[model samples]
Target: MDLIDRVNEISKRIKTLGTTLQTEEATKNALIMPFIQALGYDVFNPIEVIPEFTTDHGVKKGEKVDYAVTKDNEIIMLFECKKFGAELSPGHASQLYRYFSVSEARFGVLTNGATYMFFTDLDKPNQMDAKPFFTLDMQKFEKQEIDELKKFTKPSFNLDEILNTASDLKYTNEVKKILNAEVENPSDDLVRFFTAKIYSGRLTQPVLEQFRLIVKRAHKQFITDKINERLETALAHPELSVKDNASPSVLLNEVSVELDNGVVTTEEEIEAYNIVKAILRTKAGASRIVMRDTKSYCGVLLDDNNRKPLCRFHFNAKQKYLGLMTDKVETRVPIESIDDIFEHADKLVETLNEYG
Candidate 1:
């Protein structure tokens, strides 16, 4: 299987098992071991992946780490595992921090089975940072995230690849944090400087207050407008057109119809159905996905996409959809079938329209 398939499988397993491994040992057995296996290491082989791994020097004797990965007798990576639901805070891995200082390991991983955070030193050699350089949440894995994660996989593991980008990720994150703070609370000096420029050297309490409100409102509006523009771009695909007065016969002939029952009836439905079935088949947990139709509306119900319940289908501003869950739904895509799902002509269109 490819990385996407592997990630989808892992996501299903993680969801089925849930993130609640009762004990630290169980977490090591269930979460950490599988992660090592994913990296192509034999968990049972001490030469590749060793448990209770020892180091040459550390804070105290008998201080064993959860796992250590070795290559040519040199420890290449260190991992510290916590109970599944345990928070992966700095305090959780103080022992790993001490062991890192004396080990030959260049990379350290802290995971709670559900969340993995990869860490490395930037300020000093062999000193691990409290914050992770790359993080992956097992619950909602994305394509880009999986791509970055492939770097740590044993076959492609390269220290230079990780180190070369660590500084940029760290500094970029730091800059974003600082900018976010400024956006929330503008500094007095910054406010005064801007006030001087705008008011021509006049500073007043009422004026400052007014300027603060203005700045806040401007910032909020800018973000809102940018978000709407992006959403429009994402949703404006030609393939995502709504057909006026589309009947069931037209839909069956032109588009695909996948039913809630596990059966593919029409030639178009069979083609499109195969695509969606293939997606949910690998991950049984994704079986919450269902399809149905009525006189007015025909659509699919996605229980959760990326760990959130997506909203119902509403095509042509006439077909009203009522969801099983009455909670306020957000982030929904409306379409007749997979063929008309995207904003542009895609493989979905090619595959489904072929039946017509």
Candidate 2:
């Protein structure tokens, strides 16, 4: 299987089996090992993937990480793992922090099986960053993220390449998350920033609220229009795009170049995702409602998974349809706009109740 498929298969394992995994050893065996294997590593090869990999720090003897990945008999990365559901603190990565500089490794990974944080020496040379350079939610799989993780695979591992972009990726992800939050519920200052461009009126509460929705709509529209524009351009002239012979990293850049850059989600789809979450917040916790987007449709599930979706979004087409499932029956409800999500509130809850 390809890296995305392999990691996605493991993602399924995490969604279903992770909550049931009760101990550190079980996480190591069931989650961590498979993750290592999915990265094209030989879990059985002690020389390549050393279990209980040790590093000595003066009086601290037998200081070990769970696994140490090597190339050419030299350690490139160290991994420390915690049991599933265990809260990972800096203390959990203490050994990794201590071992990072001591060992030849430049990268360190701290994970609780489901959430992985990658650390490196961005702030200080050879010292592991107090904050992780990159983080991954195993259950919340993103193709671009999986592609980035593929850099660490046995076949593609390159220290210089990973380190060179580590700083940029770290800050870029942080910025995207901040922008994403602003897009959902813009800050008053942000609203004012846009209001200044159009209005000369006083900054009042009602005006702020009025401008917030407009700002959000404009942002969403901007993204949607840009995406449509690029898609049209690419469709019209595929050769004008990045060549097939371009390097994987160059190809990776092509994806992030777009504003609505999600592999599965679009600007409108994210708005829909938020609306679905808001509606289902009362039915069950918002955390339980997972959105998985595929080529054909975006599947919304109550942990029912892609196999048995609670609903699907056919938003790609001109006429948007919300596919709802209830009592072993599936039905598609056409909607004029994303605002129509609330109209199907009763049906949304019914499917959750049926599958709950």
Candidate 3:
């Protein structure tokens, strides 16, 4: 199986057995060990994967990390494990951090069976960064996250190649976190910046409060407008709708219906497809969900069957709509952004269950 399948397998185990795992050792045997094996490492091989690997820090003896992964007779990665369902924090990585400085490992992982946090010496050489360069949650992950995890596999492990992208991934993750927070609740500085640009009056408590709400609404509308612009562009140029090396099962079909007619599949539509797939992933495999674009809307089907219509993206117009089927009747619900599809997750799942 590929990385996605392997990762999904682990996800299934977590969902099914997570509650039963009561101890740290049980968590390791049930979830963490299989994850190591998924990365093409032999957990039983002491040479490749050392259990309870010990490293000594200055004036500290026998400081042990959960596991140490070696390649070519050299330590390549370190791991620290916590019990199932435990909330992982930077404090949990102390032993891993100490091991990183002493060992030749370039990567350190802290996991609680479900969430894996990958740390590297991006901030300083031989010292693990306080923040993780990449984080993977077994229960919740995207295709791009699986792609990133694939690079760490035994076959594809390249120190320089991963380091090249680690900096960008680390900073990008941080920036996105900050941006998400700002979008949800505009910071004082962010509100003031927008206020200066648009408001002519003096900055007062009342004005600041007023601008805070305005900034929030403006951000939402701005995002919606940008999505509409992309949809318009894709509709104008149907040829550009086809992505290079696109996954047929995940995103676009091998020969999309768009090619038969003038219908164009926008990137936003592809994003919506992925979102729907993620929502119904546990109920239905991603391969079962297929994108079949039409001139009016982009239809997502189960098992490539029109009778099994899951949802549709009606993005050809100014106001986007998510076409959901219930009792064989289509409901075109108006949505501002692709993220809004998550709101009707139960309805989407219900539609899929009807077919089953």
Candidate 4:
């Protein structure tokens, strides 16, 4: 299987057997070992993966790390594991940090069998960084994260290549955290920065508070507008839509239906599709919301499933109509213009919830 499939399988295992694990050893046996194996390492081979790997740190004797991964008889990476569900903090990586300075390994990993933190000597030579350059939470991860994780696999492991991007990844992760905090609750400095550019009046406590609320609202609306703009662009260019990955048979069926019914997808119908997609983007991803044009109406489906219809646009006549599927029934709501589709945004989301 591929890296994504293997990672997803491990995720399923964690959800199924996580509660039963109560100790670090059980966690290693059930979760961490599988993760190591998934990286194309031979866990059973002591030459490649040595358990209870020992080294001396300064005056300390026989300091043992959980596992030491070796390549060509040289220690390349060290792992320090904790019990499942245990909160991983910098304190937990103390052993890995010390081992990194003495050993030839350039990378250190601290994991609780669920969240894996990857550390390297980026800040100082032969010294592990206080914060990890990259982190992976198995419970929730994206494809891009999986791709990054692949770089550490046995066949693809490259010391120089990883170090090249480590600095940028570390800084980017920190910046995203700061941006998320500022977006939700703008800091005084952030508020002042915006206020100075937009307002010439002197800053006061009341004005600061007023601008705080304004900044928060403006930030939220700006994000919404950007999402809507992208959705509209994707609708205008159907080739850009991720939903075009449908199977050949499904594509053939749609084409045949359109041909038989003499379907002509108009600009108004496409606009209605865009509006409906933007409303349900939070509930269901934009890619899962599909537009299937037919002679009678333009159908918006969930995962391209006809039975799970989200809504439809009937713009072939003088009076436009929106067909909302609720309670397994199509309810035609009459409207004067395509913009009226926004009136039933809640109903569209509710329809999607019914499928769940």
Candidate 5:
């Protein structure tokens, strides 16, 4: 199965196994090995995947990192493992900080076999930062996030490509945080600039008070306007034939269905459509799957580029009519909960298996 499916499956497994296997070794055995394998790396290969990687850090002897992934005799990635149930704080990354600077590794990962945080150097070249550049939580998976994570997988791994965007990725997030702080509370520089610009020669106590109020109100209004725009974007695409209520909770529930001719139905069919879309993304030959809105059900339209008709699941349509779709089309079984997407994830591999 692909990285996305593997993440989904491992998340479910973690929930099922619970906190029983909470030890450091158990985490390595249960979660770490599986994660390495899913990335298309051979866990059994000592050359490629070296566990208990020893490195000299000052006076500390027998100091070892959890694992180091090497390619062409050079370390590409370093991993520092923690106990399964342990909460990972910035304090736990001291080892990684030391190892990252000493080694040739461009990327560093801190994982408890569940949450993976990827870090890279932003301040100094060829070094790893203490803070993660990006993070992926197995407990909560999203399609776009999975796509980003796939860039690190063994098959697609490119050190130059990763390094190329490391500076931008690392600094963008830091910039955003600083901007948010400034927006929340204006700094002395901002106040001085605005004060000088608006009240240069005609400044009095009353005018200064009025100017402050005006600036604050204008800033608040600007923030409010931007927030409204964001909310509109989030709620932009209305559910076709589902419901037009303004309540977000209600909309979220009805989002998976399409009502037809005043008949509310087709939740199952929509789920099947999602499955097919997921499968299509895994196929290298397949073009973008354009899903259509329907009154009674969603439609997975054929991409002219691929010229391949994938399966259709008509939730409201009769079973006999469902077979009317092209015979060459592939079928994917429907899954219920979003968490259950991992159940038949192998089908995704089947779709991509032909690529090679």
Candidate 6:
């Protein structure tokens, strides 16, 4: 199978068996090793992928990393594994850090079998960076993230090529996070800076508050417009429209009805669904997590039926609420950010397993 198919299969396995991966060794055998296998590496072959690979050197003898990937007898990557559900921090990557110094490994990955963080010596030579340059949450894979991961797959692996762009990717990801925060809740400095560009105003408290509201509204409007444009592009294909050659019953209205253009799912709803999917992906496959939309609200169902509602998005107005249907009853919860869906993991899982 191709890389995308491989990832999808791994995703399904995580959902189907995540709870059972309670121990560190179990995590390695199930999640971590499968990831290595998906990366076009051979987990069965010790020549390429070494298990319990020792990075023992100097005073730190017998210190072993979970795995070491070698290319032509040259160590290329070192992996440090943790138990499933373990919180990953830089401190957890210390084993890989020490291994990077003694071995010729260029990349070090720290993972809890769910979250993988790729580290390299971008800041200084012979020392791994305190922060990872690339991070992938296996539960939430995107097209861009998949493209980034394709770079590390064995067939395309290149040390110099990755090094050349690692610095930029690291800085760009950080900048994106900052910009996301500013868009959601702009700071005083950011507000003033933008306000100065569009409005000639002093940094007074009342003026600052007014401009903040304007900026926030404008940003939301801009995002909404972009979403609409994309939706139009995806749904409104002229070729698919009824032409003069069509039968009288196959009119434009008929085609529109077939497309269900009237009951379009908004981008906000799609994002909310994706967030819910991300939260529950480790416990269920994508096929089982279905989203259905209507004019009133977007209903995300577990088995493509309303009786098995997973969550619902109510985004018909400025103030949006998420309906937690874990109890199969609409429990409205205020949602200001898309990240809030992650907070209901237990509820989602309980609801899903109960239905199953």
Model 2 score (lDDT): 0.81
Show the colliding residue pairs in model 5: none
Better of 1 and 4 by lDDT: 4
Give the TM-score (vs. native) of candidate 4. 0.67
User: Better model by TM-score, 3 or 4?
Assistant: 4
Which lDDT tens digits does candidate 2 get at residues 1-356?
Answer: 55767787888888899879999999999999999898877889999999998778989998778999888999988999999989876567999999998999999999999989999999999898888878888877455576579788786788888998899999988887888899899998899999999999897999999999999999888766655565565676553444334443344345455434345456677678779889988877765676777678877876434434667788998999988787656688999999998999888887777654
Task: Report the error of model 2 at residue 247, Å.
Answer: 23
| Candidate 5: tens digits of C-alpha lDDT, residues 1-356 | 45666787788888987487868889988888888888877889989999999999788767899999987788988899998877886578878878888898988889888888888887677666668877778887555456567677786678777777667766775885776665667655665568888666766667666665666677777656654553454465332332223333233323323222354324465555566666666564233454554564445554321223343344553331231133455554443443354454464445334323
For candidate 5, the lDDT comes to 0.65
The residue ranges of model 6 lying beyond 4 angstroms of the native Cα positions read: 236-356
Please give the distance, in angstroms, between residue 59's alpha carbon in candidate 5 and its true position after superposition. Answer: 2.0
Let me know the TM-score candidate 6 reaches against the reference structure.
Answer: 0.65
lDDT of 1 by residue, 239-284 (tens): 2323444332333322322223333233333344344545444443
The root-mean-square deviation over C-alpha atoms between each candidate and the true structure, in angstroms, is 15.0, 16.7, 14.3, 15.8, 11.3, 18.3
Native-structure RMSD, model 5: 11.3
lDDT of each: 0.62, 0.81, 0.85, 0.85, 0.65, 0.80
RMSD of 2: 16.7
Once fitted onto the true fold, the runs of candidate 2 whose alpha carbons sit more than 4 angstroms away are 89-91, 227-356
Misplaced by over 4 Å in model 5 are 175-355
Clashes of each: 1, 0, 0, 0, 0, 1
Candidate 6 lDDT at 167 equals: 98
Residue pair clashes in candidate 4: none
Best candidate per TM-score, number?
A: 4
* Candidate 6 lDDT trough over 10 residues, lowest sum: 240-249
lDDT of 5 at 180: 61
The TM-score that candidate 1 achieves is 0.58
**TM-scores vs. true structure, each candidate:** 0.58, 0.64, 0.66, 0.67, 0.55, 0.65
lDDT of 4 at 55: 89
